[model samples]
Target: MVTMTSPAETAPTPRLLALRDAVREIERHAADRGWDGEVTASVFALVRTTDALSATPDLAGELPETALAEAASDPEHLTSIEQDGLPEATTLEELLAQLAWPEQVDGAAVVVERLMVPPEAEQGLPQDPEEAMAALMAHPDRTDVRLAAGVLRTGESWCAVRSRSHDTDDEVAGSPEAVPGLVEALRATFR
Candidate 1:
């Protein structure tokens, strides 16, 4: 599933490279903590700029995308949670844990990881990417089936696709910008 691009075309800028490193760091942390889940469900977001969003620290590291979206839907919820009180933010993870992202995604770094299942394979596909992967691996007919995913965040989603059964090693997938009508599609899925 790796996208074959010219070396010149695939060269990452310094910022993007740094972002990639951050994604790796976070992922390694996740793995160490046994946060084994679908890449998407385990999505993390951060502020692209160093500007602080709130009184909290400038960085919002390794947060669930669903939590980010839910908190954005209502500010009062965050206020109420704050009033209730939680752990003090002494580290970036704690900071992210304590804060609720408002209805603003501008300049936010999103890292998504999801399993891509084919229509034919949908019957067995599970909502959890890890489970889906395990099922896919066990299945006999594993061809042309891949997990289309967005692994890291660097303006565009950083792709890391791997084969379902044969090749366990992750391949360097292509860089694709946000897709048009994706929001609508997601909404429809929820409905």
Candidate 2:
């Protein structure tokens, strides 16, 4: 008897490979920057049907103040994309549940979260996380707190670190992991 395996069983699809590669690069960067601690990464895919990734401005790109509300699918926050807000997340599951992805998705991104101070390490940690994050962002000393990565429909790839003080052009020793959780997350969605 002859047997044959499906495309997925035999080898990864193009989209899968793209996501894996993007995640790998991001993780490598994280590891190099020493940001790969016990932080739970909440991964999401902005999947699309085409080969190009959409650069369309969406609420997800907003800063935390507005981002938190928009991500929760609040209508009041739906006014515009110029607002910058970061979503509030205590748990990966909670973050995943609250995400407001576009109706059309074509790519995947991983969000690795880190606190300015560890829960146990916080001697005077701010009760509100937004305050802590804002404080970190406002410091005169700039640090790269890199966070996310993506493969767009344009076939363009990007890895992002959530540092207000740093630019994407700022080069660092990138040494992301061979595979990050984003791959599994995207696969779970499409498969």
Show model 2 residue runs off by greater than 4 Å.
1-8, 36-84, 111-191
Q: Kindly give the number of clashing pairs for every candidate.
A: 2, 28
lDDT at residue 30 of model 1 (Cα atoms): 40
Best model per lDDT: 2
Candidate 2, 124-155: lDDT as tens digits: 54789898667655654534455565544434
Clashing pairs in 1: 39-113, 40-113
Model 1 scores worst on lDDT over the 10 consecutive residues at 75-84
Q: For every model shown, what is its TM-score relative to the native structure?
A: 0.37, 0.35
Decoy 1 TM-score against native: 0.37
